[model samples]
Target: MIVITRYSVPEADSVAFQTDAATAVDVLSRRPGFRGHRIGRAADDPTLWTVVTEWDGAGYYRRALSDFDVKVQAVPLLSRAIDEPTAFEILAGGDL
Candidate 1:
């Protein structure tokens, strides 16, 4: 399973936004079934950032969100993510 969240942050808040994203990754990594995670800024648009996480399955991803620690440390950043579908299934991919 894949979860992708996009964030549009002002230049002034880029550092803070990346810090929050890192915190979110740290928290989520502790959850069961977490495969891997990555955070990146768009090459053409620096203000556009994304947090992408791979999980064993959709259930693991959902359960990670429900974790209390994740709620406290990650939810704030995640809540600021663009309002759109974030979860997806991999149709084809190599190890990431």
Candidate 2:
């Protein structure tokens, strides 16, 4: 499964957001069932960003969120994601 979290950051906060996002990714990477992740900025909108993470499954993703390190290092940044569904069940043919 994959999780896509988007955020709208002010131009002044870009650098800080990037640092915090990287820290979140690092903490998440140490958890079990983590697959990979990417941090991306939209070409058309510089203040728009997304954090995409792959996990072995939805369970793993949820469990990761409960970890103490993850709660401290990642949750804060993730909490700022746009108020929309973040997780998606990968389909047979391709992504959602």
Candidate 3:
């Protein structure tokens, strides 16, 4: 399963937001079934940020969110993500 979270932050808050995003990734990476994650800023809009993560399955992703460390370190940051669907099932893709 894949999760993509979008964050709309002001330029002045970019640094702090990135720090929080990094901490979220770090906390999630330590959870079971975590696959990988990446954080990126929109090329067209610097204030737009994203955190993309892949997991073994949807269950793993949900469980990870309930973890103590993740709750403390990641949830706060994640809460700032745009209010919209974040999870998805890949329909088609190719490895690089």
TM-score of structure candidate 3? 0.96
Residue pairs whose backbone atoms clash in candidate 3 = none
Query: Please, what is the whole-model Cα lDDT of each candidate in the order they appear?
Result: 0.95, 0.96, 0.94
TM-score of each: 0.96, 0.95, 0.96
lDDT of 1 by residue, 1-96 (tens): 899999999989999998999999999999999988989999999999999999999999999999999999999999999999999998898753
Question: What is candidate 3's lDDT per residue for 1-96, written digit by digit as tens?
Answer: 899999999999999998999889999999998989989999999999999999989999999999999999999999999999999987788984
lDDT of 2 at 41: 97
Show where candidate 2 strays beyond 4 Å: 93-96
In model 3, where do residues sit more than 4 Å from their true spots?
Answer: none
How far residue 75's Cα lies from its native spot in candidate 3, in Å, is: 0.3
Model 2 residue 1 CA deviation (Å) reads 0.3
Model 1 regions lying over 4 Å from their true place: none
Question: Which pairs, if any, clash in model 2?
Answer: none
Root-mean-square deviation of candidate 3: 0.8
Each prediction's RMSD over C-alphas, in Å, is 0.9, 2.0, 0.8
Ranking of models by lDDT? 2, 1, 3
